[model samples]
Target: MVSSSSDPLATRHSTVSRENVREEDALKVLSAYLADDMRACNQAIIDRMQSSVPLIPQLGAHLVAAGGKRLRPLLTLASARLCGYQPSAEQQRHVGLAACVEFIHTATLLHDDVVDESTLRRGMASANALFGNKSSVLVGDFLFARSFQLMTADGSLKVMAILSEASATIAEGEVLQMSTQNDLSTPIERYLEVIHGKTAALFAAACRVGAVVAEQSEKEELALEAYGTNLGMAFQLVDDALDYAADQQVLGKTIGDDLREGKITLPVLAAYDAGTEEERVFWKRVIEDNEQTDADLPRALDIIARTDAIKTTLKRAERYAHKAAEALEVFPDSELKALLVKTVLYTVNRVN
Candidate 1:
């Protein structure tokens, strides 16, 4: 039952708890378990790599230890537990699989930093910044290969297929983003497609593989897949929002880093659509042209504010968050299930 103080969305829309306080508690419980599981997974990857080059292991650990939310592994572990599969001692196999997911994710980050020439990640100097692009690229390759080897040990051909396909999609997405860079004329539909490949594919697969690991019914598996895909979309949308809305000190990157990188996000897309012909011309020169002066930043911000595009993007993200929670209705009530729903909410609503 929901408490009087709870938000309607948190209660009326959920098969889980109605209390925001209770949901917060549920998130903490799941977060604690997630931390423990992730620690083990990290150790397993480190041990498997066994690199002779000390810097390889050290740099990999540095990135891992920087410790973002570990949301992917949490989704895997939580999904399995919520789906009426009581974990046994054999849970390590699943943890190992989860670790491989994180490894793949990390490898992508290492490569992404080199590709973007990013200097900071998670409030620390990015690997490419510290280790140079060469070391970062090679180490990322090592992690990618090691992740595949670990996945092979599971003996689940289905899991292997999902992960391998996701890896390929991620690469294609990266290339698509590369192709779209600095193109002011790029369509919103194309941007969504790129994000689906780059971000949502792995998230969807992570949740889907959890259901696979638990041997859930096909219906439940598809629901989880939908849930993960929507959640991933919402997650990325919020990240894009923060790119514009957040301060540089808080975001751990420059306020206009995406603009500087020539990556047009949803806010820019919305602003562009709402802008006048004069404003559009300005964006073309500033966003698409490399020779333009820094004088364009204020005007871009002014245009985004005038269009109220951030508010629109936030609403869109909320719609997906609602969809993510609705997908969980097929599952019976459980703490694990509640955690998963809260995760969707938090991912969309979070400032960072």
Candidate 2:
């Protein structure tokens, strides 16, 4: 049974606290507030992504130009200001580090496409699809190397340690996901572990490093880290839900790609848990044996709808979103804090 009061999916038409803020509005406010710093970060990204190897710059530029929300780097910059970072060399270091954060994220996307055999990204041909897997892998390595260069330029052992650890964690998470893929029995705790490494680790690092550069208190650093971590959890949950629910146009990826890829996400898990023996057999054939026919997607959607799976998954996402907002209570109220809080709402509302 779907609980309209608890399930955001069930209450889509209702105005709630999380539904009050628009992502575009929050981004506009954040961009305007961090205008100068963002400009510097963009320049630094361009400079660092350049390589003597023509293929490196060409492929890098292709993916970078494809465009994304730049959410990770934005977290780095925003966390800095939220922690009272002033405009100075310290601020410049924040820009450079923010660029490094972006490079790391871009590199991961390149590698992920190759791993997933994905043909599209951000509504265009993926790097692997456009440049071939070999070029994509090599260029991804180039970006990873470039990110380290920027990290070293900052000359802070603390920052280096944070980012390098995040890099390693991301790789580990990808490998863990590979292990879990095509296996329906994978537990929810394990799934959470996978996302923590693949996605939340960087989010935590991005915000933590910002506080580090600002020379903020340990409490402040941890507070921001908590904020980013919960926000990332909500973000990925929404993304996973979108795989089953969103239009391909709005999502910029094929609907039911997760189903085709034999990956089980939260919605699928929720449905599976609630399914009858007959439905379980269906899941085993399609997810475990990879015997999906074209009609499987619609059937899967039907099963998902029959249960409260979509609503349950989205309810979990809202919990994490609320946790993200709660973490900001540690910081004094300010425009940056309010915007950061609103951004959490914006992220979860992507489906709506």
Candidate 3:
């Protein structure tokens, strides 16, 4: 349930348990378990990212070296293992396919940085910031082409279809977000649709392809897809909330960037709905009118504090996290399963 406290900051001090494993620790454990496969995948990524064009390789290396957690590709590897995929010829296919997933993810990030006009990514200069928007966009297209090559090399039409659809869906989601940007009238349902397409579609495809490559049962594939989709939702929700709540240093990006971009995220919607008439004017002036001033972010935060927006947004995230865990219940207990469940908790606890 969302907190009822009128004190907007009350949730920050609420005594939620800190017993859940940290995100980094859980990732470390997963990485250790999949060390060999990850090594192969990393090598594959390096080999594939190379280009005769110096600028292409240089720009790709810059972003790839920026050191994201590789969580999406990790999900591909871990889900395959969770489905009892053993190391062998078929398992080598998983490594290559996992590399493909990473390529797709990296391509999206390149394009996203351009679209968001973001200066920083993964705590470093964004590709567009360093290489220029034209280079970033073209390199992103190259990555997409490389991803398709890997998919075709896998020789599974089903896998190709799933990933291709996800790619298209991600673009659609970006367009949807653009249409909704600065529009406070955007409903929560539409916002969710945008996230499912932009964020969760790739995640769902990543896990589902793992099952497909492993030749797991349909039920198991569906379960992994559910886990991935819900986990992605939770991940994006926490990210949205963190734009308002997180420390700029820890967040790796400027706080209030969403507001500056006139993006109406869930917390903003909640606060707008719950705000008084006078407060609504402030929101309209800043968000709808795009007239945010230097002092507006703090006052916007103050308005959010008076509402249950942050807590409610987090509550929704927790619900999705719980569903993600539940989706894995069909799989037998193991260290992998346990770690995946812990990952859900860690995702939600990022702002805690």
Candidate 4:
């Protein structure tokens, strides 16, 4: 045993790193990989999306140009490399596939903001905020249609199936989550199902599509898929936790955006389950009845602290982190594989 205490990647450092791998360093690694891969992804997105409607190209270009972490594309490129796909031989086929993943994700975000009536995204005014909801929704649909066209051009039935299924699952999960907004009784399992569908399914598909494009062995594809799914689940769990635990400046949104939106996340769910009768009534008034004072937020925060919801959720995320690392055992040990696993740990463990 290397002793988890000495191995930041091995230990569940949900709050801080035990080893010297600071958050900045981890972000630097991810940022470098994203920069290297994004130029190709952007070109592919642009080349495939030239359109008759001028606004279609303009909106798509703006969204693409608006920077994001580009996590999905990076996963695809890294998985392909780790699985022994040679760029010289494939000639950037994997990069094209990765761009497709990013387009689909961006399209969903555009529609999601419209549906959620969100004003800010990626630390700036959302498309729905600047251009009316109608434009955002229509442009989002255009992106989806364009993404499918690009996927079919890839000529891999397996890749098509994986991405198509993920698109459908994302729609279903969004509906499921919409149905539960403000319903206090929504169980943890249902919440998990929603996140798995809405988020993890796409992440898993991104990696699996890369494997398919590379014609990797079925076992290797399965490993990559598992890695993607687990990492995604961990990522979302941490995101939900951070909504309550982090400050507005750090989170890039109003603190308690979930609460304001009446979105009942895992921390809130755990706190409700662990609260007293009085606390339960408070949640009902604030979260359910939509009648709450400013005091409610601090009270809710107190309840979460009392229930240890943050810690509990962190532990669950850590389990998924370990599972994501384990999924990569089948791949030959290499720098790419090590970085992939490290990124998973860093994503779930980061405070912001």
Candidate 2, clashing residue pairs? none
The order of the candidates by TM-score, greatest first, is: 2, 3, 4, 1
Backbone collision count in every prediction?
0, 0, 0, 0
Q: Whose TM-score is higher: candidate 2's or candidate 4's?
A: 2
Using TM-score as the yardstick, the better of models 1 and 2 is 2
- Write the residue-wise lDDT of candidate 3 on 1-352 in tens digits: 1113332222243212354223435666677788988888889898999989898888877876887888888899999889988767644778888999999999989999999998878679888988899998999999999999999998999899989999999999999999999999999999999999889999999998989888999999999999999999988988898888877776576788899999979999999999999999999999999997899999988888789788888999988988999999999999899888877776777775
Residue-wise C-alpha lDDT for candidate 2, range 1-352, written one tens digit per residue: 1112322232243222735334535655677678888888888888887878888878878877997878899999999888888857544888988999999999999999998998778889898988999998888888899899988998899999989999999999888988989888999998888888889899999999999989998998899889988998888988888888887875577788899998868988999999999999999999999999999999999999899788888788888888999999998898789889878876777665
Error of 4 at 159 (Å): 0.6
lDDT of 2 at 278: 97
Candidate 1 Cα misplacement greater than 4 A, ranges: 1-29, 33-36, 86-91
TM-score of 3: 0.93
**lDDT (CA) per prediction:** 0.77, 0.85, 0.86, 0.80
Arranged by lDDT, best first:
3, 2, 4, 1
The superposed Cα distance between candidate 1 and the true structure at residue 251, in angstroms, equals 2.8
Which is the leading candidate under lDDT?
A: 3
* TM-score, predicted candidate 1 vs. hidden true structure: 0.89
